[model samples]
Target: MATNRATKSGFAAEAQRKVNAKYSEELAQECLEWIRTITNEDINCGGDMDNFYEVLKDGTLLCRLVNCIQSGSVKKINNTTMAFKCMENINAFLETAKVLGVPAQETFQTVDLWERQNLNSVVICIQSLGRKAGNFGKPSIGPKEAEKNERHFSEDKLKAGQSIIGLQMGSNKGANQSGINFGNTRHM
Candidate 1:
């Protein structure tokens, strides 16, 4: 009986390995790049917002990345459909930026200082999205209280991490909440 159980277990393991092997490192990198592109297009920190061409170009690239992700060519690393939907919204925002003609390299500088500033903005947005997703398993639906908490958490996180977004008294109060308070958010 033990031998039979071992054989069954081995078979199941092999099947799981096969499934895992289908998702390659290249695919994972593509997903990450797509996410980064979307974030860069959506968020910005103080810098050079002067180049119309670069902004438009970056917005276009951002839109393309979103299109690929939503087309299902790039499978999300996380096994959550809501993530897929978030990607869709991300794509929409990129398109909006493109239409608005936001400059791509607005933060470029002769030195790494400005580049780091821009990169930090991108990182902050991604981290905020990650925290929200982590706290509320479903990006689309969380308890009203949970969503509120996430917003407060995201605000505090951005302020703490980004020098540009310094913590204000309003945000401090929001961050200091002891429990979740669902005033008006809805679950998806």
Candidate 2:
């Protein structure tokens, strides 16, 4: 049973790694470039999953990235080989990312990076961070977020909408059960 569980775990990890690999090279490169732009630090990764994970596994780069967007957000980055300290850095970065408009759903857990469980999630988090970079006067990564469209309506139009049947409620206007027959009533 334990062996089966281990096999399943291995399969799941391999699958996640492959899915992470599917992100466009252009996107990964763009994200790396954006990170350099914001942090003003040169990263040595080749934008591949392995390189990306290695460069960021310590959470130093991530802390720096978030700090670039919001200064003093992490307060202090523990630059040490200790595992717990590294986890702290990641946690700080995640929290700061949340404050910087990177949604909680977009953030990755420490284990996701530490154990290489889902580096794709880390990449996605960085992409989201890049999108929000523009708000903080930094160059954005990936595509720009869409702008909202505001519509104005007169009071008459607003009141009229309330009386109309909603699409979800559906309309029976052209839909009729008229002359309906289940095969032939005599055949029953």
- The TM-score leader among the candidates is 2
TM-scores of the candidates in the order shown: 0.20, 0.78
lDDT of 2: 0.79
- Per-residue lDDT for 1-188 in model 2, tens only? 11223433487777866866666556666677777777888787477766776777788888988877888788889999687888888888888888899898988888887766676777888899888888888888777987899999999999999998878987787888877888866564
Cα lDDT of all candidates, in order?
A: 0.35, 0.79
Which candidate gets the maximum lDDT versus the true structure?
2
* Model 1 score (lDDT): 0.35
| Cα deviation of 142, candidate 1, in Å | 16
Candidate 2's error at 147, in angstroms? 2.0
- The runs of at least 3 residues in candidate 1 whose Cα sits more than 4 Å from the true structure, single-residue gaps closed, are 1-57, 68-117, 127-145, 148-188
Native RMSD of candidate 2 (Å): 4.9
